[model samples]
Target: MNDLSRGLAYTFATGLLWGGVGVFYSKGTEKKESFYGFMFLSALLFFLLTWIFAFPQGAPVREVLLVAALMFPAGLSGQLGFWTMKKALEHGPHGIGWCIVQSSMICPFLAGVLFFGDSPSAGRIAGMSLIAASLLPLSAQGVPAVREDSCSGRFLLLIFAAFLLVGLQQTLSLVPSQCPTLSAAALSWRVPLVSLVGLGWLGPVLFRKTGVRCGEIGWISLLYALLVFLGQLGIYRAIDFLGKARSSGTAYPAACGMSILFFFVYCFFKRRERLSRRALAGIGLSMAGMFLLAIS
Candidate 1:
């Protein structure tokens, strides 16, 4: 297959893995599992795997290391996005959380144009406009995802935070992308470092949570880490194969839309959650926006 096709395929598979994360991780959280602890374990496992399979190979790599330093904030931003995402999942359905987090496509597109001197096409403009417009309907959800008496504002804020934080994280990667030297090893080092930082905050929670045996939770967290790595690897490969423009502006957001599609179907078939009509409409609107973004 050609670069574009391979990129799109990888991107879509990434979305599938991400879509499943809602099911697996959310179920773990539902079992009264500690979110931080679970994340810590997953992060630890991911770090180890990266170190074993993708450890830094060059010596005195000052430039790449400097770029890696800049990439550190991207890791932090991702963790923040992850924290809000879990909380949002607690407040709403899996699809809602996915929608908010996936909507982070805007920042990358802006970074491409503003910093990289990339030209924006009319189709991209329209696609982005539709994406922005779709967020309104989601915020307009009448019923809260988690609670009957709870204010929808809380969930809405969670969604907004998820959108902003993850967007920032993705945009930060654009910096590394511009530097060919850094682009390849950027996340290889950054992900493990992020996992280490995650341990600092999430470690205590792992120790304190009741009945939280590491042995029992090992498989679940391992699965989470594997999924995380798969999704990240796919996106990274897509960017490398297809260039930052299509990967970010089109494949990235479009993959997110695919994720929401799987999530909506999962929720419907499993009958795990009650999805309102407006929520369905919001999802559909988001899908339309992604389609435009893709074809553009």
Candidate 2:
């Protein structure tokens, strides 16, 4: 349809892909299927596919080379983030990890405003404050009110780190300003982050935990990879079809909303994670900020 509609659709789709990551890991039907393993493989596939599809029409050779070279960082980030995320999943409930990681959205929003000169509205600012406020209770350093196991502060820290990287990845979206024509430049800024997921292998390697079967895991990882590839492509297409402002306005907020919705429904029903008044308020506040940011 129109640019705004397209942007909104793409952004929402990205969130759906991102939010479903945990679901994919959960559906592995085997404890041996580590989230890190899935994340690492998925990211590698996504990046490779991105390169293939992006360059098929005779993209700039120099830019592609540079983009490929820069992919190292995105890979690195992904590896680390995935490790943290996987650990969080193992240590915490399914959807709670998603909520925790999302707590760091402020990082990118700030960066966007500072580096990209994207101004947030007053409503957005207030919503952000509420989001930050909502998180205060979670910082108390105790086992979450309800869970399979006690969530340690260490896990919280890891989740926060994940959030930071996600934010950084979003900020990396600004890399195109320096090298706009090179599709690689835009994608490269985040490739290392995805690559960081490889670090998860350390667990299986070091701890001697039984790893996922090669054949069984391949298809799952491939699906994840393909979804991620299409999601990023959609985002890039949104940026192309709709200018950054309108695109971000529609997409970012919609993505957050969708992810949050998934988290709430799944955590309450499937995983049965306990939700406190504070957590609900936080979710609301964060969503409000996201909506404001979109309109802003």
Question: Over 4 Å off in model 1, which ranges?
Answer: 142-146, 149-151, 180-195, 206-212, 244-247
For candidate 1, lDDT tens digit of each residue in 117-180?
Answer: 5557787777777766666665454224555523366777887897898898887765655665
Q: lDDT per residue, candidate 2, 126-221, as tens digits? A: 656665665554333212454535377767777778877765554454344334566634444343333344545556544655554556578887
Q: What is the alpha-carbon RMSD of candidate 2 to the true structure?
A: 4.5
- Once superposed on the true structure, which residue ranges of model 2 sit more than 4 Å away at CA? 1-5, 26-30, 33-56, 65-71, 130-149, 177-219, 239-243, 246-254
Error of 2 at 63 (Å): 2.8
lDDT, residue 7, candidate 1: 70
lDDT of model 1 at position 226: 83
Could you list the CA RMSD of all candidates, in the order they appear?
3.1, 4.5
